[model samples]
Target: MIPVIKKRIYLGLLAATMLLFAGALGYIWLTFFQQDGGWLRYITIVAVVAVLACLIVIGLGFAGIVLSLVSEKNITFLNKPMNFTFSLLYPVVMWLGKVFKITQDKIQRSFVEVNNQLVKAKQGKLTPDRLLILLPHCLQERECPNRITTNTENCTRCGRCPVGDLLPLSERYGVHLRIATGGTLAREAVKKLRPRAIVAVACERDLTSGILDCIPLPVLGVTNDRPHGPCFNTYVDPDAVEKAILFFIQGGEGNVFHVSAN
Candidate 1:
């Protein structure tokens, strides 16, 4: 199953690469090389919008979300106009995260975690607290490896891994946190935990499905810090995840992680 998901991601990337190369070549062929205007005609309109949203969400972190209420028609949409609208509104909520200094990378990483939640939804799984972490297996620089599969017993609750700090933070105001290897694992973890609210981490590719999967659950999707593609080496921003969790999960105020909805 892991291999299958990997294959899917690989194929998706390869196809995207090929399409980009072909488009570039095709444009050069028709333009300067052929002395023609060229077909600037075709574009990744829908894909572009997805990319744009991803950029705004990640690049600007939640700060760019300040513009979320501008309206879809104001932003230019080629397909899934409704999706574009919803995507645009992310700024408003995410912006709350940025106000708290949740860094863009952390926001993107959270979305990746949410991707895991989506898979849980398909299996009818539920989570217990508001904070759900679908983190990569690797540890932060000098940090111990996450033991999600092993009950986090080795966790020591040292307050190192974001979850370590999260345990106290969540407990302080009643929030929950879970870590999973990937999307499928995340969903399963969430289902078993069954939290009432959710503050999730994931990437754009995973966000759409993950956020949508937890219907009726108020979920705030935060992106991760993977400059490279997802894999065993991906890194997550614990600070950002914590901040979002503090906001949406506990409604806490005035902390390094506190973010307002206004």
Candidate 2:
């Protein structure tokens, strides 16, 4: 299946859920207001109107996100609000996906795909030094005695895993490269480096959560391949990582991965 198809499915589910919720509210207003109790009726009307207003704002934010996916130029104004809307609606979307029996990983991967498009739409050129490449600890060979989590530079350039290949890319591009053992370490690395943008490599779950956690900071996620199992010995495409790096530093030019809502 096309990767973006899942994202479109997610969006469709979200829209259907919102429509159903609004229909329920309308049904309540129509059924309850007919009895006419006085102040209670007024209060109910006010509450329903407020909820509808909130939904309208959410709908507008959703539209902005859809627009960003198709737009080639960065829509700078909607960046923060779109991030906030994604954070707000993610749980609801996940629940909806569960109702429809969609695997959470599929939904998460879809979310990441949509998010990458949104980030690409809003991201501008940055100095290479301001870009950070975050790698999962699993990228290192499982048996390697060296622990690169503390310091990625500890790797002796041994070609045991993708880490060795990535290290040279970092050096060549003059970008900050760090290995994160988990979410906590990833957050800490972001805090310490304070990068303008990030190119992250991880599984679907981690990448989705990490993107949401780092609000307003553009991150292009490259999902890793789990050949052996979950986290034991994962691998990521070094070419995807390089393209993501170039996308940020060159502002959506030069072999950047492109996805659209269309």
Tell me the spans in candidate 2 whose CA falls farther than 4 Å from its real position. Answer: 1-6, 255-262
lDDT of 1 by residue, 1-262 (tens): 2222422332233233334444655554455443433333233343445555454433342222112222211122222332332344345435544655655545544434433332222212232353465543433223466454556545666644444544454445455555556678767876887766566665654655566666445565665555445543345555666665554433332333543221
lDDT of each: 0.46, 0.82
- Evaluate candidate 1 by giving its C-alpha RMSD to the native, one decimal: 13.9
TM-score of 2: 0.89
Candidate 1 has a TM-score of 0.42
Each candidate's root-mean-square deviation in Å?
Answer: 13.9, 4.6
Q: Candidate 2's residue-wise lDDT over 1-262, tens digit each?
A: 3334547866776676677668867886887777769987997798788868767766776777777666544566666556666887789889888888989998898888888877777646999989999999998899999978887778987777888888888887789999999999999989998999999999999999999898778889999999999998789878788888889888875556533111
